[model samples]
Target: MYHVVLGVDEDEQRAESAAREIANLPGGSDEKRVTLIHVFQDNPSGASATQVASVRDAEEVLKAAGVDVSISEASGDPADAILELAEEDDADLVVVGGRKRSPAGKALFGSVTQTVILNAGRPVMVTGVPTEA
Candidate 1:
């Protein structure tokens, strides 16, 4: 079993695509198991039900694919939450979704994927989110 923490965002299609890709991976087969996690920071304004639904919907896709899925939520900084979970779970791999950014921008304010890859003891997979044309 592998710990596959798929980060979800407002674009349901992207998250669904990510979940589908994870599902198709050899390690995500019926013989294997994976966990699905979503991080939610407390935005003072709050998140609409639609955003939460996207995560729940993605979880369903992974579960239907035969992966032993666990859905969870986390608060605080995105990178910190992921790293904490990785260490606490002794995860084999950490997966994340990212939007492409300039190196300078990324370096100034580290991306969640970049930070996790640099600090995580385990392997990390980062999927870049496609900006709608």
Candidate 2:
């Protein structure tokens, strides 16, 4: 079976995009499984991964497409958590969402997507918010 680790943040658009990508993979969903993960850097209220809006939206899209879905949660650094989960799951691919940022902005704020792409030993798919026509 093909496995994928989909790392989602608070951005619902990006999460849906990544989910759609997985749903549209060449092979049918019968052999595909997705682990939807969300990492919280600081959670004062202690939210679960299943409680994440982005994760819920992605899950609906994936399930409607007949893909198997699972949820995982972690605390601390987002990139590190995502990578760890991907490794543990032996994921065939890691998917993440990215926002368009200026070089200076990215330098100042840092990018979890960039870090994951650079560090992931396996394939990483980065999805961005869709542009309006």
Candidate 3:
């Protein structure tokens, strides 16, 4: 089984791309379990529509492919939450969405993707949106 990190900032394309990549990954079976996770910084009010929509899109795609899928939400640091869940679940891999950010941008803003990639013990697959120059 694998865990896909769904950030609050993610869009439909990001969600769909992650699902497509998972679906195409070799060795998938009906026995495989895929969890779509969205981490909110606070989320006192509950999940945002965007987050719900993204999860639903990925869930539908995976379900239609006959893969066992589930959705989860957490509140905390995005990178930490993702890694903790992955470790807790003993996931085979970690998949996440990324954006094209310059080095300075990443340094200034701090990237969840980079943090997860650097800290995660298991494999991490980063699917990114194409950026225009």
Candidate 4:
């Protein structure tokens, strides 16, 4: 079975886009297992990954598409947590959502997506928010 680590942030659109991409993979749902993960940088309230709206939405999309899904939560640096989870799961692929950022902006704020792409030992797929016509 193909295993994918899907790292979802707070953005619903980006999460859904990534879920849709996984759902449409050529091998079909039965051959794939998706681990939906959300890393909270700060959570004084102690929230679970499934409580995150984007995570829930992505789970719904994946389930509707007949994909097997599991939710995971971690508290720490997002990129670090995601990469750790991928390694632990022995994921076939790591998928993340990225926002459009200018070079200067990305340089100033750093990018988890960029870090994952550069550091991941496994293949990484970056999905972006769709643009409206």
What are the per-model C-alpha RMSD values against the true structure? 3.5, 1.9, 3.2, 1.7
lDDT of each: 0.68, 0.90, 0.74, 0.91
Ranked candidates, highest lDDT first: 4, 2, 3, 1
Which model is ahead, 3 or 4, in terms of TM-score?
A: 4
| Tens digit per residue, CA lDDT, model 4, 15-110 | 999999999988978999999999999999988988999999999999999999999999889999999999998999999987878876866324
The top-ranked prediction according to lDDT is: 4
Model 1 misplaced stretches (Cα beyond 4 Å): 43-51, 102-110, 130-133
Q: How close is every model to the real structure, measured as TM-score?
A: 0.75, 0.93, 0.81, 0.94
Residue 92 displacement in candidate 3 (angstroms): 0.5
lDDT of 3 by residue, 1-133 (tens): 4444443345777788788778878766565678788877767677653357777888887888888887767777879888888888888888888765687786532478889889999888888765559
Model 2 agreement with the true structure over 6-55: per-residue lDDT tens digits: 99899899899999999998799998999999999889998798888999
Could you tell which candidate, 1 or 3, scores higher by TM-score? 3
Query: After best superposition, candidate 4 residue 45: deviation in angstroms?
Result: 1.1
lDDT of 2 at 115: 84
RMSD, model 4, all Cα superposed? 1.7
Candidate 2 Cα outliers beyond 4 Å, as residue runs? 103-110
The local lDDT score (0 to 100) that residue 62 gets in candidate 1 is: 79
Estimate the TM-score for candidate 4. Answer: 0.94
Stretches of candidate 3 exceeding 4 Å from the true structure: 1-9, 48-51, 102-110, 130-133
